[model samples]
Target: MAARPIGLRWKLSAAIALVSALVALALSLLVHNAARASMLDSSRDAQDERLEFALRAYDSGGQLVFDARLDDPTLPEPLRRAVVKGKRATYVEERGDGPPLVWAASQVGDQVMSLNGRFADRDRALRRMDQVLRVGSVLVVLSGTALGILIGGQLSRRLRKAAVAARELAGGATEVRVQEAIGRPARDETDELARAVDALADALRKRLEAERRVTADIAHELRTPVTGLVTAAELLPPGRPTELVRNRAQLLRTLIEDVLEVARLDGAAERADEQEVALGEFVRRRVERLDPEAAVEVTREARVRTDPRRLERILGNLLSNARRHGSPPIEVTVQGAVLRIRDHGPGFPQTLLSDGPSRFRTGTTDRARGHGLGLTIAAGQARVLGARLSFRNAQGGGAEAIVWLPAQAETDDGTPGPGSPGPA
Candidate 1:
């Protein structure tokens, strides 16, 4: 059979209880010994006083000897034996007779006299003391054990709470918390453990969020080209197959190229040329290249240190997302080191706003139109470029995303020049 494992709480409690019991037992024994010694000394003193009075009576002679009673009720039976055998002393005790007292003979002023009752009643008294000590020690040890167990149990309970919380945390339950008793401050080991667990959970949550964003972006970017290729292939006529095939083949090539661009943005074996670029000029050039029908706006000029290709992909994806999700009249703003992209469409869906963005979460409900990769790719690129990106509904009924780039220097031409590239 396998041996059962003992818990930490039980181990600690048992250790405390055992130590307490041992100490209590040792103390009880020491006290018992001291009390016994004191009682024995008092018994001996009383016996000696009785013997002294008897000696005086015997020495008085005549009527004094007849009046003197050797067996005094004040002295126990075992102590009375001190008078017998005269000059010889013996240690003997009987039940209910107390302990034996020491007796001896000594000469004073050329007279012979008997000395009796020195250490009287000690044996019986000692026996009674031993019994009492044994009983008292038992009681004291029992009481101490009980008290120790109670204290140890309470301590174990608190420690167990922390242990349970630790286990839950290890198992990935980041939100698990210890329940505090009434009027108790939440500043114990359990609370500390809970805090550490919460920190880990928060970090894990952030990492998962980043990963979901990457996955969604990849899916979204792939969906657009895939859809285009599928549509082009479907449109090919069965008759005059060669001509239809040629058009389909051209559409496939365009789809591949677009997909490759998105892939590069996703860090698919392509490295960015890290360089300082003027933010105002970069944004202007990108806007100029966009579909003329899409009304674009630029509000401020700010320089940011970033990779040129990465920055372009970031801008391109944002623009693509805006075009796909929003109306034609798009507004773009750059103020300080922040960039704002706003769309006049129906704004963000309530679900998206609440859930935030994920891999392949597109604005349009059209399942066949595009995969929701644009925002994911843009967000990923922004992260790689050491920038922050966020999306929300504008106050005046439109979807807006704000991007905060690293601070940059203003050029002589009023355009922003790169200061330093921040960490990815």
Candidate 2:
């Protein structure tokens, strides 16, 4: 099975949250480092003041007054080495159980003097600041995530609306359009997308209108000539050759009628004249009249309310297509409100199965050829009757066309109600 796709809203929110977290962490680290350095500088200055006072008292009274000593053995080795080599030196000694000690040392003629102090107060303040910073960073991240979700939701809704409009357009709702409020001098990508969709819909509507006019015109123009041709063919001497001409002329006339029906279906002006129908009997009757050789099976008897004429047209077109493009042994099955027609042939082409049939583009093989209007007309008529029609390749290897008739209101006894008017 294919993996489900992630929605754009979640994608955008995750991205924004990640960036916000990184930014917050970086800023928190920077603030912590700067505050730590400032505290350290203040401690250094206090330590220097103590060292100067101790040195001055030793010179005046020949004794140390502060925490000062002559070359203190407890002093760190690195600090002593630095003191002996310079006039003054300072170092910090850290102990695990308590605040770190700050040390200052200087050479005194033949000996070295040193001062030491613990920065317990400063350490406590730094710890408190670290806690505050951690809390602040978390709050920043949370707020940023909330903001991201709000922004993402708004954009997702707008994009979703645009997507719905586009889908309706693809499904032949040419009059549908997307509406978005846009600025005059400044607009975002969503605004641009909405404008493009609306423009495309308008262009499509106009193009379809032009195509419908052309189709109606061509079909109308050919009608008179086609009728006259049929008459002429009938007047020919009765023979095999004359019969062939007459059949061809009648086929031409049928094609012209199919074209006109297609135009009418496209205009969306046809309405279903609903009536109660015994699906099994209807299918058998239509099959017998349309293709006597085709087999019919009433698997589960059902009576539906629908337009009989439109339903028959759908059935006739399917049977005609099966005979023209399929092998022998065509079969029709009626199960409840569903009708299935199958042909033992090569099955439908992949394109037809995937994208539905297109006019004048029959997916025909060497053994089969047609003008490709049969399935299209059938599909259109099915729509006019408010039914669902689909084509697929049967698992055992054959083409199957299925029609799901529209449901009707049930009577008090749980059976389908009597015939009623369809959609207005």
Candidate 3:
């Protein structure tokens, strides 16, 4: 089983959210660092002022010296070492149970001064700023997610609409076109896609129309000559030599008819004049007309509403192909909505089974005599009547053609199945 694919909307939304979160986090870190540095600078400046005051008030052993309680000062070891080396030293200490303290030590010509400043007020402000920044970061992430959903949803809908139009157009809906709005100053990728698909559809429609017209005109022109040839062949002497010629003339006539029929179908000139049809009787009559020796199995009697003329044409063409290309012992089966015809010949060639019939291109190399129009005509007729016609090879080796028709009524007994109109 395949896993369901994730929608583009969600994917885009996640990407936007991720980027936004990273931006927010980086901004918070920058602000946090800046605030911490500012607090430290303020503490250092206050300590410098206090150190000057302590120096002015100092008088130690007749040598003026800044006095400061440094015996228990919470100064870092680096700051203490710097002070002992007669260098100015400053450090901030954070008290676990109380408040933070800023300490400074300086020595001037054998006089040492040490000072401490209270940093509780600045620490409280920093903590408040930290809280605000944290809250702002969360809000920023949430806002980014919501914005992503809105943008992603719109994009997803636009892309999905274009996809639907293309799919419908591909399914033979000639009028199905992707409509892109004009006069927009800004056209996005989706708009470009819609325009491209619409252009392609228009070109395809014109090309197919031209091809159909050429086929119809050629077929119409050849019909008169073909009819004359058939008539001339009929008047010929009844000799074995003329037999092949007559048969060839008839084959030429069939090809012309097939071409004309396909042209009509392509031009949408055929309509289903559906009527009640008996499955068993229809198959029996068609088979009898083609070959009397072929076997037919009627598992159930069915009354189906379908275009009788089209159905007849479809069956006639199938039987004709079977006779020409298949061996003896052809069998027909009619059950409910299914009609399967199989021939005990080399199952349909691989090419025929895969690609169906192409006009003028014989379906197989072995049976190259026919023009390959019979199955093509049958397929067209089947489509006109809203039925499915498919070809496959039988299990034991033989060509099989299955026509699935809508069953209006069916029964296992030999009685006439209920006569009702099925979907045309």
Candidate 4:
């Protein structure tokens, strides 16, 4: 199995969350540094005020006061050396036992007066602020991620709806469309994509309508002349040449009928008259009429509820297709609600197996032998009967076609039950 892809919503949301986290981190760092710088400045200012008072008291009594020191050797060497140079200086010394100490020194004649202040309260406040910033950053990131999920989910839904519409269109559901909600001055790429898809569906629907109309008209027009030709051929003298003409005329008539049928199927006007019937007996009867030479096998009898006429058409087309394009020894098998037809020919061409049969294309080898409408018509009728028809190459070198009846027609034990041989 192929690996599933990551959704657009997650990719967008992650991007938004990462950017939010980075922004939050940057702002937290800036605020933390700025607050730290301001606290340090306040500590220095208070120490300076105390140092001036100490200097004044020393000058009045020739002794220091207010816990002041004269040339304190315990002070940081950088601060003491700066004070000795006859200039003021400040230093912060962090102590393990207490909050950091803020030192301010000033020169007074031949002596230096210094004051010390501690910022335990300020340090605590800063720690609280840092905690608040951390919590706020987390909240910011969470909110940002939530907002991203909301926006991305909306966009992803729009794109998903458009994708579904496109797939339906490819599957021949031309009426399927993306319903986009538009607002003035707020159009986005998704809205544009929806509009483009709607436009494409319209174009395709119109083209297909024209093509079907042409096909139907041509078939109707040729029907009269083709019928007259068959009548004229019938009146000819009984001879080999006359028999050849009659056969060709009949074939032409059949081709015209097939064309008309194709047109009707394309217009989606065919409806099934469903009924329940024994599947194995039905195949045996159809095989008698279609190709008595083909082998028939019924592993275990099963009954199915489906359109008998449509089923016959599906079976007839498959048998005729095999007789015309396939090798000898065509075989039909009925097992439960499944019917399989195998032809010991060059198995269908690679193209036919892959893309399925297209009208007027009987593969690269069988192109001249027959028109490619047999499988197409069979597939169309099978669809109307709500069955799955598939083609594949058999393991022993032959073309095989399998038709699986819908679940409604199947019983769990593959035996006649309440709905067997009843109205569908």
Best by TM-score: 2
Residue lDDT tens for model 3, 376-399: 888888878878788988888888
Q: Write the per-residue lDDT of candidate 4 for residues 1-424, one digit (tens) a residue.
A: 9999989888888999999999999999999999988999998988888778877778788878768887677878889888888888889987897778899998888877787878689999999999999999999999999998999998887787778778877877766776543323237887777788788778888898899999999999999999999999999999999999999999899999999998888887788887879888989998998899999998766767788988999999999889887888999998777889999988888888789879998885646678788899999898777777889889998899988887444444655433211221
Q: Give me the runs in candidate 3 sitting further than 4 Å from their true place.
A: 2-6, 47-68, 71-74, 81-89, 93-101, 108-135, 180-186, 349-356, 406-424
TM-score for each model? 0.42, 0.90, 0.82, 0.89
Off by over 4 Å in 1: 1-270, 291-300, 350-356, 407-424
Residue-wise lDDT of candidate 1 within 1-424, one digit each (tens)?
9999875555655676577667767876787678666765566455445545656766675222312343334443343454342432222233455444443332323433334343545556666767876777667666666665676666566667666765765543545654432114446665565566557666765675576467557756766777776667666666677576666666555445454445554443445456766666777777778644545454556655678787777777777777887876787765545667788888888776776666556756785545666676677677666677778888877788777676566654676554443322
Model 1 has a clash total of 13
RMSD of 2: 3.9
Model 2 Cα lDDT, one tens digit per residue, 1-424? 9999987778877887788889988998898889878887788788878888888888899888676889788888998888778757678787898877888887777788988888888999989989998888788878877887888887777788778878877777666666643223125678888888788788878888789889999999999999999999989999999998998999899889989989998887888999987888889998998999999998777778889999999999888888877777999998667788999988899999898978877887553367888899999998888787899888888889988877653433456542333321
> How does each model score on lDDT?
0.60, 0.82, 0.79, 0.84
lDDT of 4: 0.84
What range of 10 consecutive residues in model 3 has the weakest lDDT sum?
Answer: 415-424
Task: Give the winner by TM-score: 2 or 3.
Answer: 2
Best by lDDT: 4
